[model samples]
Target chain A: MSALLTDDSIVDLHPLHIGTEEDGAVEVGRADTGMFVALPPEGVALLRLLADHLPMAEVRRRFGDSYGEPPDLDDFVAGLHECGFIRAVDGVPWPEGDDERGATEADPAASPAGGTTMRGIALLGGLGPERLRWLLSRPLLLVFAGVWLAVPALMLADPSLAPRPSDALLYHRVLPNALLVAVIAWTLVMLHEFAHALAARARGCTGRFSVGRRLVFLVGQTELSDVRTIARRQRYAPYLAGMTWDLIVVLGCLCCELAAVGGQLPRTVTYTVALTFIYQFSVFMRTDIYYVIVNALRLGDLMGDTRRLLANAVRGLRHSEPAYDLSGVPEREMRIIRWYCVYYLLGSSTVIAGSLLLSVPALVRMLRIAADGMASGPAAAGFWDGAGFVALVAFQFGTLGYVGFRDHRRTRAGTAATAV
Target chain B: MKIQIRKLERIETTVACACGS
Candidate 1:
């Protein structure tokens, strides 16, 4: 009970971070506790009254003056306590051990990637959110968009600037070409992730870069949760910024390719960027573009929700239940989910199939070439190079297998715990 | 007006780079 009948029945709340939501809601939370909740307008009013340190009786009277009916303050205050918003009740400190909230701060970038939990290391000049004031300007966004557009515009004018599959082989020695692509592509990848962190930071989000593996491929990710405080309009830049960087890079590489005297280095980079651009369309893989689509549509937990819907459908097949229950999903979002689920299904199958067909054969062909090189003695220049290539392939697939197995086991354990 | 109290949300946003085709 709130002990509201007394004259001095006052309650104190922890400092709250209150902000507006895109959908006419309110976001309230403690940044330290990492606990946030979305509330309607009247709830915000009630919170404001409590935050002003009003006594419960006065709070109810003031709230009733604005709204026709008084809020169920006991229930509301209880909810606040559950949310870790209560600091004290009637001069008594909030209990420490009893709350299930686990209110300790979470390391925003603490990732369990590669089977290790570690804080994401900041790289390549991460400026604080306040110092990056220009990121909020509209003109800077145009400059970014204009540069992205210029890449294709120039390629359209001169088709020679377009990337080709032939550009994959960059140097006389296979090892040097592989090394160069790895170096440049990874450097580009880091810059791409850094762009995301910068945009997020500029919008008052703190995040760090970490290396993680997704399915069969290795990836870099930025862990930022505070972007939720920003509206949907502001999120697009952070999500699409990486692709914009890739395009800007493609444009730069294309110009450099033209300037170079018959050298393939720039073209090689253009091809790598082009391949990455194509990869952004592989949305089922939860790429940056997936987040863009998610934010654009104002959908919550699209990936996890759709995955749950599918899992439920599989479990309910004998009962003839539908694949998804549309009761909880909003009508507008349901339309997108219908289309997106289909796209996800088709896209996932296509990617798995395409990778198996194309990448497997490509890997095999490369291995065959390396084997021919290895057939010769150490006197042959390609012998050690072939060995290096073989080792790289082994490491790539080796990491993939290990991560995949770990994910599978974790999923099974989660399922078992859910059953229990 | 009675305002509804929703559950706490963990607004985790991960910006990942995976252009793997």
Candidate 2:
């Protein structure tokens, strides 16, 4: 017998942002809730039919007409229902296992699928609401643009303003000085994220401020909910807001450094500012500049596409089956992806090499100094300094290790769930 | 009136049926 179906069992489609994947599959994302699912062409066709709110028999009939055979409508609908993509709009009860799934209205951040978790309380909901809206207005945006253009020109004219590796506030006496720098740097990062939130708010979009781990580092994130709906031009404000704040800080520090050339201000101040500026340009880490590039080119998933393209190239060389199929990528994006792959590889190599050459050596030296000081005895002043240094290093690396471990477990769980 | 108009425009542009039709 056919499954019990009711005329009142209308399916309400969740607001989804759809995009085409590289392999010609359809990717549908509920941006606000962060529910993402990929589907084959036939699955997408079924989704379209469901979105029409047709009765079960009508959907089945359409599916049969389109595919020239009977389709597993019940299984497909059940999967969608399970994923929280559709809901009953007519107050009708769902089939057996559906009600047992419980309510799906909980915060997506708390139970994010694919092993991602956005932890921490939101500090600010809407910041400087009216003032920010005014600042992001078209006329004021021109002023912002002028300032953005002038800062680079001003920096270029001043040879002292050029960012250099020596600009990093790394000194021999590294305990108190390093701690102070770390505090200030973190404050600046917070301000950068706040700028993004403000810009998003200005464009009538809500930005949620939270601290989350991105791979190894604890990052300040502004989750902009309405970005997909907003105009591309308005979207630019939030994407570039963090970098704009960084530039302002850099310029301000440069001015101060210029004024107090030798004595009043520590060179470390200017150096720290320059270091932040340089860090933003590390597009390999999906920094602000990376988003600017992606938005400017109007390409979806440039990083993912580039990675897949490179992986496929390597596979081709070894005559092994490629892990990613790139045939569905549009010609325009494919060309851009090819160039991006080259740049990304070269830039990543440079960053990796720089870390090995400079950061590793500095870390090793500090570790040795701290170890030696500890060995000298607790009575020595060096012992306290060494202990502080060791604590700081342990705190930083321990946090990194813990975050990486959590991410690994989440990824394994997600993969196992998908396999099942 | 302006806010309502803007909201309508946003809904028209952002919200869409799964079928392009």
Candidate 3:
């Protein structure tokens, strides 16, 4: 056991914001790690006292006065200490020892990209002006509402405007057009991510812009560090902001296509924009829509919980050791999990079907075309195109494999740590 | 008693509590 609490021991509690007092519970979030702990009222009171930098003896005395008994001060403190919620101020050894195995240290820059590449860019480090805040509020929100309503109405009126899988493949045939569309698409995605950052900034939260890969897809992420501290209404703004920009681009493309004299450029733009808009609806990946759903539903660890549930079910069928035991899950969340399981199946199937029908075919065609060009002659254009296409495919798949490998290794390390 | 501490590390939602909390 660690040393007992003394009257003079100084402690430094991690910076956190307490959630609204509701139902005899409070949500505490550490700002640095973005970790939330739902505590009973008594726990909140104890933590508040500790946060004031009071000695352990004072905290326990006050806690006893409030709760009618000298609560197990040592046990509670040990729990908090284990969770990295509190630290000794005078460099005293923690009761749990220096084994930082279980505590989650909040390091925002941690990426699967192996630390060599740039992870993210901090766009807004601090709160901005009143005007910027207002933009993220009523007027812009109303504008987004209009866009949301207008998009479906427009698509309904002009069914032809909806991009088809075949249109995406058109880029694969025309190399120059494909290159142009790729650059434009990349720029638009970055802008979409930037909009998220702007929304976060408007809410007086720091927004970080980052480019990373999730599986095979390249992603731009906006990290709103203080999002949990804000109201749910404010939280939805950043989540929806990226999709709002995507919709705008789609609308702009449609308008351009309607006004064009006669060329592939306008149609290409429309195709790319529409495809990008559709991509945002990919719920399997942590897309903008995924966040919107998560925030709206108030689900905590939905994916992880659902995954564990599935694993446990499979293990039970096979009569093997269960990977997860979920008896402790709240009934309400379990109900939600059931619904999420259905959606997960549907979403995953759609992605698989789409990839098989579209992406796989496109890749095979590109490979064949590259091979033919190389075998034909020393044709400079053909050689360059073939090399470029090969390099692009190699890089994409290589990064995906590398990231997957890293994640698997990290997961093993974490499991080992837990075992110890 | 061995309490399983669930770590909620995702950006969307998280909750920290002991096994029986």
Candidate 4:
């Protein structure tokens, strides 16, 4: 919102990289930093005029002649500077700290090496990305489709083979059952993320895998920010790659289950994989499928936009004033968001309610079991078993809280720093 | 008359865009 520049302000515009046209706006930004902004066609035309280093008044006059109205030159230019879209203002490089979003992504303190704490490890054995790129090749599409379709076909033939919650409980001891399934689940999670990384690498984009929280669940996420630079058609594999990997894993588990070997291991694997796979369909949590929906629909910042639209509605009700502008949201996007809002509430509520209600009975049962084991002393057969399960529960919730706090605090610090 | 410059997306910082497991 700063308007420090005058009519004579000599702005040296940065070299811009123009990206694909999404809906009506073109994605444009500095390639070096990977910071991009969506600008209307008219806005891009104005930017072209500014890049020519036109005089401030002349720039405004030209835009007025074309559009029938002149924009507020000072405010518009200042806004660009605030977004780090301007290289320099008045012959001095604009200080880049205004872009808090960029800081959150690229800041080493917030995200290690551009959104990855474990850099290059996800690429498999220090091998080149080319080695894994073929996993996402178009020719393999038929294989993947067959593998995914096998599950429903098999399930229909034998109803007992469908993945269920009971299948996850494989052993009498809680620790053994939890450990075996957790190991497999986490392994598949990493591979699921690797699929996304490999898909992006195929298209000459490099992203990293990291552990992050999504609502109540501790999730494994891939930071495929670079995918935005690619064509929309090429973007799908990267976005849907994780789900593709999950389907393969599920197919393997089903085949193993039908083999009748591995005792209960295959069933546990099926349960764990199936539950997580179904969770991805919960698009409200921004799962793998959500990105495809967003990309395919060209719904840029759908969640954030909907939240603001909702806030504006509430604010208008309370104070007869809106917090955000309503004019910018295209009616089509607004309609989609309206349906998204209903789904968001239902999905989010289900997670929260399940966390509260279902956990109570589960925790109570665990506590009772722990109490019985503790009364028998340390040397008893089941004493440490209950203790171990309780500890596992504690560890899961503890890590969830700790990571959530760390992420929240880091974002708040970035915003606060940028505000100054 | 006034012109509008929409600031729909300042920067696309997709934190945890795709999550699984």
Candidate 5:
């Protein structure tokens, strides 16, 4: 006896399943449903016979010749389609078309265009819809209001609330305290991830959770959700979600700082929150600002273009004309993207050079401070004092350096690829 | 008749958004 199955059963079966390994690896498995399903005694044999590389007519004839009556060929093929054992190629009509044997090769969603759609959707899911909608609607307005109220109020109340070495040295003065700030930032980032997950789930998609370094900053994120079928406009919200929340958090922090100042609360509470907000906004590296610019300009497609441009540039250096063609891109968009590449390329270089020029003094100062502390006493230069200071300095300069290097490499590659 | 022909031509030529080459 064979297991019973139906067309609906085959249709409902997931295209793929990922299994976990004992050693923390993932293995993807293909489910053989529909026509390939186990059936009563001779039926499995019959299906297997048809699965051979013989033509449809020949298979049907052979089945009929052996079994007296032929199985319904259309139904069998439809079952195969539902099971995903086979699929139509070129959107060609049913029956006589060739069935490409490999599972990966016959994928219904194989095109690069479809992959881009999926990636776009997944990025939006990561952004979260409600928060993203808020950003798109008017995040800058809220940010401005908070800045206007807080900056003036705080400055008036505390004349010394500036980004100076005195403030940096007076670390004990800033609070709700470091722990409280940590808790708040962590909560906000988690909320950002939740917004993404909820949006993805709403779209009938699923994803996995992960924690890793998003550029230089550590971030917790959900896996990219399948967005192939999602509409473009519907997607913009999810992409902007995290940044939206970040804006709100910044505003809330500013408001708290304002309250603390106006109501005569602890000075440390006001300063700490304000500083955190500023630190979040400081564009020394890619953050919310990166997403805003990337989406606004629709430069997701530029990764390939950058490579092509670099290749062309390299080719042009070798020969007169580019070996590869770049005529497919729209003239206006291409012009704008190229200009963006040039500006970003130039801007990053300036930042690195400027940073190096400025950082030497800071680095020397930090080293000198560490040296002085060590000379004075063990209490003055504690175990982690120098290491921590050095690490922080490295992190600050390293971030800018990394971005500069990546941008330059892309430009060089693009220029070389397309002789840009 | 002209409008019907135009519609037919569009039906034949109009590509699905997902079908980008």
Candidate 6:
């Protein structure tokens, strides 16, 4: 028993208490993380009869005859430990009188990897069809969508369309075609998430919506249920649905371009749609393709695993008590993560190289265009060359910085409150 | 004995146990 304890060195272990009934069955009330227990009959009876104060051998002897070779109680305890039902007592201190065992929220980071509380969002809980119709009929949303479609249509029809000063400054000089790509990408992203929410609702499950960072990039989405509970096909839908919509939009744009009776709309719309689709397919970054690869390999928490591997490698090099603890993880998962690390190491380099190669030419062209615009700035054509370019760049950068700062401040505030 | 209401009412009773008893 001591040997088992020694091998499974559980530090800061928090043990739970089980209650027994007159029927001689035990019910484990999980107090930590608000998780409940669902134990088998044999395990329940064993827990009911066993003495909390006695050694393992005594408990084993009581059940060994009937259960044949007697299921290893040590193994049972280890399973319980893994499930967070019990904790090792040795080398860990407990409060003097606290017997009602439960987990405390002392560590804010203690939730499962990538676990987060959804803030500023609510679930669309079980809304009836009638209610949904009413919600959709809201005047503001309908107006906005109608306006989005109408303005573009009107612009396409009008032949006297000169690039507005703002448009020229923002799109042409500052951002080139990339800003159009971003706008289109954003639409697709939103539509993709909408599909997930719709599917989740159809399945009678409510989803929690949040606008936050998925790794480094900011995204907005609703996480329906635990990914573990979702079917493989169902999980694949939300990730790919947006891309599906993007393809559809691109096709629509192409149709418009091919059918249009000689106008700027054809080129503008086609270029916008194409750029959006290409931007989305840029998979080296955490995009649809990244998720597809991660999910296909059944690698849950790949990001967390990558972080742990990096930390462990650093620790091993220094020869310290690996500040990154691998003891809590199962050996099988750890082996899988090792493979993932090797994959990431090779894959990330290729992605970076590809991005650099693709971006450099585009960037050079943009710079050349900007330079030419600066040189040919005439007083008759309004001051939209260098000055306008600077303002647009400043605006984009300022907005991006604000978003990053807000996230940083929020995380810091949460950490500070947890510390208190 | 209980007082009757003007409107038809259903009366409910609860049982309590004492350990000393």
> Which structure among the candidates has the greatest TM-score?
4
What is the TM-score (0 to 1) of chain A in model 6? 0.52
For all candidates in order, the CA lDDT equals 0.65, 0.56, 0.59, 0.65, 0.38, 0.42
Interface RMSD of each: 4.6, 17.9, 12.0, 5.2, 20.4, 28.7
Q: Which ten residues in a row have the lowest lDDT in candidate 4 chain A?
A: A112-121
Docking class of 5: incorrect
Q: Where does candidate 6 clash, by residue pair?
A: none
Q: lDDT by residue for model 2 over A1-420, one digit each (tens)?
A: 124445435566776665553344555545554344556677777778878888777877888897888667666666665555664544454433221112122212112211123322333443656766786878877877876886678768977666664544445565545555665666776777777767777776656554444322345555553465555556778878876776676667667677775442344555555565555566654556666676677665566667667767878999999876566566787899888888878877776677678767987987898898889999997888888877767766675466556545544333211100
Please give, for every candidate in the order listed, the TM-score of chain B alone compared with the true chain B. 0.23, 0.16, 0.24, 0.20, 0.17, 0.18
Residues A12-68 of candidate 5: C-alpha lDDT, one tens digit per residue: 222433322211222222322101122322344344454454555665677778777
Write one digit per residue (lDDT tens) for candidate 6, span A1-420.
334453324323344444333123233433322222334456764554342534455556656665655656656654454444444344464322111112223221222212232222334555643544332334843543554465446447762331232321224434434444345445555665565555445443344454433222345445443322334444554455444544455445445645765354444444444443443444323445556665575443444556556666877889866554445344555787787677656665664565468644754665566566667666523234444544544544464455456545444443211100
Model 6 regions more than 4 Å off: A1-185, A206-229, A260-286, A327-332, A347-392, A406-420, B1-21
lDDT of 1 at A271: 84
Order of candidate numbers by TM-score, starting with the best = 4, 3, 1, 2, 6, 5
Give candidate 2 regions above 4 Å deviation. Answer: A1-9, A16-29, A35-49, A59-84, A88-123, A126-131, A161-172, A208-219, A258-267, A314-318, A376-380, A415-420, B1-21
Q: Quote each prediction's TM-score.
A: 0.74, 0.71, 0.80, 0.82, 0.44, 0.50
Assign candidate 2 its CAPRI class.
incorrect
Error of 4 at B3 (Å): 6.8
Predicted candidate 3 versus true structure: per-residue lDDT over A79-185, tens digit per residue: 66655566565455544322122222222122322211222456655556464787776777898899888877877898876666455443445444445556666
Sorted on lDDT, best first, the list reads 4, 1, 3, 2, 6, 5
List model 6's recovered fraction of native interface contacts, to 2 decimals: 0.00
For candidate 1 chain A, which ten residues in a row score worst on lDDT? A103-112
Q: Which candidate wins on DockQ?
A: 1
Better of 1 and 2 by lDDT: 1
Per-residue accuracy of model 4 over A1-420 as CA lDDT, tens digit each: 346576666677767766756678887665434456677777887888888898777888889899888877776676577556777766777776455233333232233111212222234324565777677666787788777788889989999988877787888776546655666777778778877777777776665555666667777776665566778788887777777777777777778778876778778777777777667777876677777788778776666666666666677788867766657667778899888878877887887788678766876776787778877989996788767766766766686677666665555455422210
